[model samples]
Target: MIKSQVGRRYSKAIFDIAEEKNQVKEIYEMLNSAMVLYRTDKEFKNFIRNPLIENEQKKAVLTEIFGKDSSENLNILLYILDKGRINCIKYIVAEYLKIYYRKNRILDVKATFTKELSEEQRTKLINKLSQKTGKEINLEVKVDKSILGGGIIKIGDKIIDGSIRRELDNWKKS
Candidate 1:
C-alpha cells in the first residue's frame, strides 16, 4: 500500500510509545474513535479532507475537537492528517492494529465469504484455523456474493481460496 511518510512516521512513533507503556490496545481504541468522529461529523470530515483549508486551520480545528482529552502523542497524529496525509489513516490503523496484535502474538485472519457466517460457523472456523496455523486468530470477515460459494481465507501472505469463482476459473482452464 502506498502510504504517506508522515502517516508511517506518526504511526510508528505512537506504536513505539504505546508498546513501551503497554497501552497499544487503548491507543488503537482511541484512534478508532477519532476515525469514527471523522466519518460521522460532516463538517469535521470536510474540514480535514478539504484541500482548500489551511493546514493551520485544520490543526486548530483538531485541537478544538480533541486536544484536551487526547494524549499528547495522539495530538501529533491529527497534524499528520492536517498536512494532507489523511488518506493513509486506514493504512496506519491497520498496521498499528497488526503491530498491537503481533506484540500479543495474535494472528489476524481476514476471511472473504460468499455469505454471512453464523456465530457457530465462525467459532468452528477459528478453532480449525488455529490448529492448522498454530496461532490465535483475530478474525475479520467480509461478505462478497461474487465469491458464489465458500470463501477465501487470508492469513498474512498466505491465501486459501475455496471460492466458487476460483473453481469456475479452474474449470475454464481445464
Candidate 2:
C-alpha cells in the first residue's frame, strides 16, 4: 500500500481511540506539537527517521518528552514506532487534523486579496463563508496585488475567483 494510505489508516485508528476517550482536541494538539518538533528539530527528526536506532530507544525518548502529558499520545507514538511507520508522522498528523476539523464543523479557507483587509471586512468574509458552508470558518488571509481588486477564496477543492484579473480575463475571452 501507499505511504499515505498507511498514514490514513493509522490516523483513523488513532482518531477513533481519541474520540472514544473524548480527547480529540488534546490528541490533535499533541500531534501538531510533535509535527512542529519533527519539522524544526534536525537532530530529533534524524533520530526518528534513523533505521539503525532501536525502537526501544526512540520510545524512551518520546516517553520522556510526551508521556507525562497523556498515555494516548505515548501509545500512538509507540504503536507507530513498533509498526515501523514512524516516518509517516507528518501524513498521520495532517490526516488526523482533517478528521478533527471535519468533526468540529470547521473549514480552513484561504483568501487572497489585493491588500490586507480591515477587521470588519475579515469578519464579514468569515461570516459569509460560515453561513454558506454551514461550518465555522478559519480564515487565512493573504495579500496578492496581482489580483488587482476584490479577492479569491479557496475552500478545499472549490475556488471562488472574484479578482479583477479574472474578470478581465473572462471579458477578453468573450
Candidate 3:
C-alpha cells in the first residue's frame, strides 16, 4: 500500500490510457499475470530487484520470462515501474486492478467462509448481493476455517459479518 507516489502516478497514467483505449480489463489481466509470474518465481523476482543487475539485464530477464506475450502497452507500463524502483509489481498490479474495477463498476467482494460453499449457494448469494449493491462483482473467495461457521462478505470497506464468532462474542457480552 506504501508504494512510491511516483509509481502511483505512472500507474495511474497508464491506467488512464488503457481505459481510453477500452482495454482496461485486458491491460489489468496482463499486468496481473506478469505480477503472478514474478511472484511465483524467486529467480525472476531477484533478477528484477537485484541492484547488481543493470537495466538491460533486468529487461532481458523480463523479456525471456514474459516473452512477447506481454502486451506492448503493458511493457511500457512495466518499464516505468522498473525505472521508478517500485519492485512491488504485485501491489502495482493489484492497485491498477482496483482502479479498473472501480472505473467499470465491477465491485470486488471477498467472501470468507468456515466451510466451502456449494456452487448453487455461491451463485444465489452473489446474485442477491449483486442485486442489492447494483454492481457486478469479481469475487475472491477464501476458506477461513477460524470463522467457526457462516461467513463474512466484504465489499469495498463494508463487511457483512454472519460468522458464528461474531455471534458468540455478542452473546458473551450480553
Candidate 4:
C-alpha cells in the first residue's frame, strides 16, 4: 500500500476509537504534540526513524515522551512502530487533525493584508467569517506590503483575492 494510505488507515482507526470514547480532543492534542516534537526536534525525529533501534526501545521512549497515561496516543505510536510505519507519523497526524477539525466544526483560515489589522478589524473579520461559515475560525494573519491595500482571505481551497494588487491588475487589463 502507499505511504499515505497507511497514514489514512491508521489515523482512521485511532480516530474511530477516540470518537467512541469521547476523547477526540484529548487524543488530537496528544498526537499533535508528538507530531510537533517529531517535526521540530531533530534528535527525536532521527531516533524514531532509525531502523537499528528496536521497536521496544522506541515504544519505551515514546511512552516516556507521551506519558504512560496517554494510552490512546501510546497505543497508536506502538502500533505504528510495530508495523514499521513510523515514517508516516506526520501524515497520520495530518489526517487525524483533518478528522478532528471537521468533527469539531473548526475552519482554518489565512488572511493577508498590507498592514496589521487593528483589534476591532480582527474581531469583526472573525465574527463575520464565523457567521458566514458556521464554523469557529482559526485565523492566521500575515502582512504583505506588496498587496498595497485591502486584504486576501484564504479558506481551504478557495481564495478571496480582494487585495489592491489584484484590483490594480484588473484595471490594467481593462
Candidate 5:
C-alpha cells in the first residue's frame, strides 16, 4: 500500500508535467512501452532492479535503450533510479495510464470468455459497455477456458459474471 502511494505520487508528478507540455499521450506510450519491457525482458528487468548497479550506470543504460525513441522527459527515469525507486516503475506507469484514460474519458474493460470473440462480437460489446458507462470503452479480450461458457466483464471495480460455470455453481448451492 505504501509503495503504491509512493508510485501514485511520482505518477502524478509525471502526469502533470506531461499535461503541461501537451505530451500526455506520448508520455503514456513511452511509459507503457517501458512497462512492457520491464515485464517481458528478464535481463533488462534484472539490470534495473539489481541493487549492485550504480545509478549512473542505470541512467546510462536507460539512455542507451530508450534514447532514440524517448524525449527529454525520459530524465524521469534517472530521477527514479537516483531515488532508488526504480522498482516502482511498473506501478507508476499503471497509475499514469489510469490518469490518462480518465482524462480522456475512456474506460478500459477486460472481458474473459471461453473462446476468442469475433470482430462483430467485440464491437457490440464495446458499444454496449460505452453506452452503459457513458465513457468510450477500450476492451481487452482474453480467453479463459475455466469460464466454461459465456463471458465475464470487468470495468474498474465492477464485475459482471455471466459464465455458465458460475450459474451452475449457484444452481448447485440452491
Candidate 6:
C-alpha cells in the first residue's frame, strides 16, 4: 500500500514534467516498454531487484536498455534508483499510464471470449463499448475456453458476463 502511494507520487511528478515538455506520449511509451521488459524478462527483473548490485550498475543497464529514449525520462529512472525506490517502478509505470489514459479520456477494457476475435469483431466491440462507456476504448482481448461461448467484458470494477456458461448457470438457478 505504501509502495503504491510512493509510486503514485513519483508517477505524478514524472507526468507533470512530461506534460510540461509536451512529451507525455513518448514518456508513456518508454515507461510502458520498461514495464513490459521488467515483467517478461526474469533475469532483468531479478537484476533490478537485487540489492547487492550497485545503483551505478543498475543505472548503466537501464541506460543501455533505454538510453536512446528521452533524457528526461532517463533522469527520472536514475532519480528513482538514487532514492531507493527502484522496486516500485512497476507501480509507478502503471499509475503513470492510468493518468495518461484518464487525461486522454480513454477507458481500458478487458474482454474475454471463447475464441479469437477477428478485426471486424474487435472493431465492432470497441465501438460498442466506446459508445456505452462514453469514452474511447483501449481493448485488451483474451481467449478463455472455460467461457464455453460468447464473451465477458470488464471495465474497472464492473463486469458484464455474456458467456454461455453463465447463461446455463442462470437457467439452472431459475
Best candidate, TM-score-wise?
2
Off by over 4 Å in 6: none
Q: How far out, in Å, is residue 117 in model 2?
A: 1.5
Kindly list the per-residue Cα lDDT of model 3 for residues 23-112, writing each as its tens digit: 776776666777787778787777667788788776766566557554576476457556754466666676676676777788989999
**CA lDDT for candidate 3:** 0.75
Model 3: colliding residue pairs = none
Pairs that collide, model 4? none
Model 4 misplaced regions, further than 4 Å: none
Off by over 4 Å in 2: 172-174
Give residue 65's error in model 5 in angstroms: 1.3
Worst 10 residues of 1 by lDDT: 1-10
Runs with alpha carbons beyond 4 Å of true place in candidate 1: 1-5, 39-42, 49-60, 67-74, 78-87
Report RMSD for candidate 3.
2.5
Against the true structure, candidate 5 has what lDDT?
0.86
Better of 1 and 2 by lDDT: 2
- Model 1 over residues 109-155: C-alpha lDDT tens digits? 99999888999999999999989878788999999999899899999
Ranked by lDDT, the better of candidates 2 and 5 is: 2
Candidate 1, pairs of clashing residues: none
lDDT of each: 0.78, 0.88, 0.75, 0.87, 0.86, 0.90
The window of 10 residues in a row where model 4 has the poorest summed lDDT is 68-77
Q: Pick by lDDT: which candidate is best?
A: 6
lDDT of 4 by residue, 1-174 (tens): 587787889899999988888878788777777778888999998998898888788888988878744676578667877898777878888888887788889999999999998999999999999999999999999999999999999999999999989999999999
What 10-residue stretch in candidate 6 is worst by lDDT? 70-79
Ordering by lDDT: 6, 2, 4, 5, 1, 3
What's the residue-level lDDT of 71 in candidate 1? 60
Local accuracy of candidate 5 as per-residue lDDT tens digits, 48-89:
888888878888888887786555668776777788886788
TM-score of 2: 0.91
The positional error of residue 38 in candidate 4, measured at the CA in angstroms, is 1.5
